[model samples]
Target: MRKHHAQQLYDYHVWANDKFFARLKELPEDIYIQEIQSVFPSIAETLVHMYMVDTIWLGVMKGNSMAEIQASIASVQEITKDNQLQKMEKLFQDLSAEYQTFLHHESDLDKEISPEHPQFGRLDTQLSELVQHVVNHGTYHRGNLSAMIRQQGYASVANDYVFYLYEGKAEK
Candidate 1:
């Protein structure tokens, strides 16, 4: 896809994440750290993983080592210990701002980036592909969040791409 299309997708990703996170904030604080049987163990873990992975990809794009990326965000203990939700909100806000600035200066979506992960091996892909992967990755885990929310007897927010579009954010 084109860089503009990728930017739109990333914008939608941020919009959807905000909707889900806002809904999460309405729930009792304990529910976020409560252990549950799901993809990532608990709501807090899932959210933290999303932030970590997003940071990793963005860091790689910016030419940082994995160690640098991991050190940039809060530790796993801090995220699950106290003020977990607030920490996540701040993390996403910071990451989203950096992502927007990166995109604004980006003009070569077709440029190839080879980022390696110890477990996932190495990827040889275009920058646009990495951007799309970030969007898709968030969407998948947001579904997990929806299920987790339902398990807690609460309704999750609507975070569909169409919903974002209908909200007129797609025009931005």
Candidate 2:
């Protein structure tokens, strides 16, 4: 079977996220939880947010109700409350695996899904578009993570999609 565009983008998303997480592991453990005045309170919190949002969207894509998604998010918050780096990394890995399974089985990337929001009203969109949004959202947060790392006087990893392509070529 041919790979869908959404799946390809999701593959890049996973690759970039993994690269960033590995770099985070190389930094001082304390830096992961150091409080910073930015989009999020700390690197740990930011990562947790990313993971939670990813989980929520995955649930949405799976046709889960909002209440179910909220419950799942609450569970994630409890699991990541301590802001431990390893715990957060594990959650991300697990979620990525889940996403992989979902993408593998999904047959209709262009299927329209109507997801209603309390504040934003309703969005009528395709599954592939939602997947793209998730990737874009992650890219934005990774940029925030990069700046936060620099603010802490640490080097950030290069996770650009072009690099992902080049790396694949090199491995070939």
RMSD of each: 2.7, 1.9
Model 2 misplaced regions, further than 4 Å: 169-172
- Which residue pairs clash within candidate 1? none
Worst 10 residues of 1 by lDDT: 74-83
Report the C-alpha lDDT of model 1 over 99-141, residue by residue, as the tens digit.
9999879887668888888789888988888889999999999
In angstroms, the error of model 2 at 137 is 0.6
TM-score of each: 0.86, 0.94
Question: Where is model 1 more than 4 Å wrong at Cα?
Answer: 1-3, 70-83, 118-121
- Evaluated with TM-score, which candidate comes out highest? 2
**lDDT for residue 42 in candidate 2, whole number 0-100:** 89
Clashes of each: 0, 0
1-172: candidate 2 lDDT, tens digit per residue: 5588888888889899889889998989888989998999889889989998999999999989889998998998888888688877788889999998998899898999999877898999999999999999999999999999999999999998799888882222
